[model samples]
Target chain A: MIVAAMLTLAVGTYLIRLAGPLLRTRITFPPGAERLLDVSAVVLLTALVAVTALTEGGGPADAARPAGVLVAGVLAWRKAPFMAIVLAAAATTALLRLL
Target chain B: MLVCLAVGATAVSYGAISVASGLPFWFPVVMGTLVLAGSSEFLFVGIVGAGGSPVAAVLAGLLVNSRHLPYGLALPDVLGGGWRRWLGVHIMNDESVVFALTRKDPARSYWECGIGVLLCWPLGALLGAALGSAVSDPNDFGLDAMFPAVILALILPQLRDAKARRPALLGAVIALVCVPLLPVGLPLLASLGALAVVPFLDRTTVEQGQA
Candidate 1:
């Protein structure tokens, strides 16, 4: 049953990933469509990040991770190196966990 | 090619991790092989681990994976041509798609991107799944968190305009508010609702510019 479920999910997911390009020849997005597509990435990514950063211990964390995320965000805004921001956030989280 | 090697490494790593973690072994292996999208796969594991229903997991995974649609649509224009075109479209996952699109001249045939994704995605997943089963404490080493960080890394670099920035802020606010209000899956839905404003905003911008 588990294998079956895995296979079913795998096939279904693959089909969706393939669906866009499969129809690309048959479909052309209208003008400004590309711009909308571009914007969607930002929105989707922000949503993902916020969800990950804010939630902890089965709910929103009281503090720490959110603070770490904010610190990372500030570094990101300042155009810091990607590794630096991530390391800083992780280090901060580890420190907070220690306290 | 370098891209192909990267894709292979990614798949192998993914497979190893999944296997080491003692998940339904085939789940991550197949998901890494076929689903080939890391964010959705992470969501899949997360939902399952949280004891959510399969329906909820599937829905959440699909919602996250929907971004690939735009990627597919945008690719042919960049790749251009016959057989290579179809292959290019097939391989349009996060990394390859972005790399192909962002290149000044890209100059890669569709087959190159297709081959790269085909190689990297499955191999990475396989590696991770295989390794996952062997490792007792995956989280202790921070491997689980690496996926999200990778995703965020890919995403943050692309918010280069006001149009992009505004919707990101809106989506973050919506997600933050919804986090307390909705169940796990529903927050994602709410975020999508927030994203609906993006198209309207873009249209209004174009009209104002013309006026």
Candidate 2:
């Protein structure tokens, strides 16, 4: 089932990519749906971040992990570089776990 | 180029992360080869790693990647002709598009896409997955937390406006509420339901913040 699902997505994504060349001129996504698409990436990603930070195995994540995420969030909010952000989050959690 | 290194880094991390999450070896490699798009590929692995339904993962991936549809429209003429068209569509990616759009030349876009894809995917998949398997401990670096943090940092700047933030907040809340109820990937998929509200959302507000 997992393999099939992956393949299904792979095919669907390929087609979407292909849609450019084949239906380029005739294509026009509805304005509202397009807006929805614009926001959905942020939406889904935020949800992933939220869930990952707050919950684990249907419950809240361990304190250290969330704390680490919090620190990372602060840096992210401040626009830290990519490496700095990842390192800060991981280091916080690692240090916390050690205590 | 700086872009190649960045792409390679993300790809390797993606491969390592997927392996750490218990994905089969072939999963990351094949996903890199087949999906080629890094963001959606990571999302797919994350969803599946967390025991999310593959069906939901596929849909969510397709949803995020639908952005490519616009890329196609933006450069209908950029795509190659004949058999190359089939291969050309496969290599279309963020970097290539960004590069292509700079000059708006068809041949240049095609070549840039090819070069970007060729350099980024395989190196990341092979080396990253190998590194992932070699590491004795993924938790040592708190890598599990690191993945989401990395992704969040990337997307954080995009939500600066209320127009974008509101929908994202809606989706985040919906997904959180569903976390205990739905399977891994479904909550994320459910978050996309926030989009249904868009027909009523002032497109100007949303579109205004956009480039």
Best by lDDT: 2
Worst 10 residues of 1 chain A by lDDT: A1-10
TM-scores of the candidates in the order shown: 0.69, 0.62
Off by over 4 Å in 2: A1-9, A12-30, A57-59, B1-27, B36-124, B128-133, B196-211
Q: How many residue pairs clash in each candidate?
A: 39, 0
Clashing pairs in 2: none
Indicate the residue-level lDDT of B194 in model 1.
59
lDDT of 2 at A72: 83
lDDT of 2 by residue, B91-199 (tens): 7765565455433474675576557766677677777788986755556657667756765666677677777778878988998999899755567768877767656
Chain A, candidate 2, TM-score of: 0.71
Superposed Cα deviation of residue B34, candidate 2 (Å): 2.0
Full-model lDDT for every candidate:
0.60, 0.72
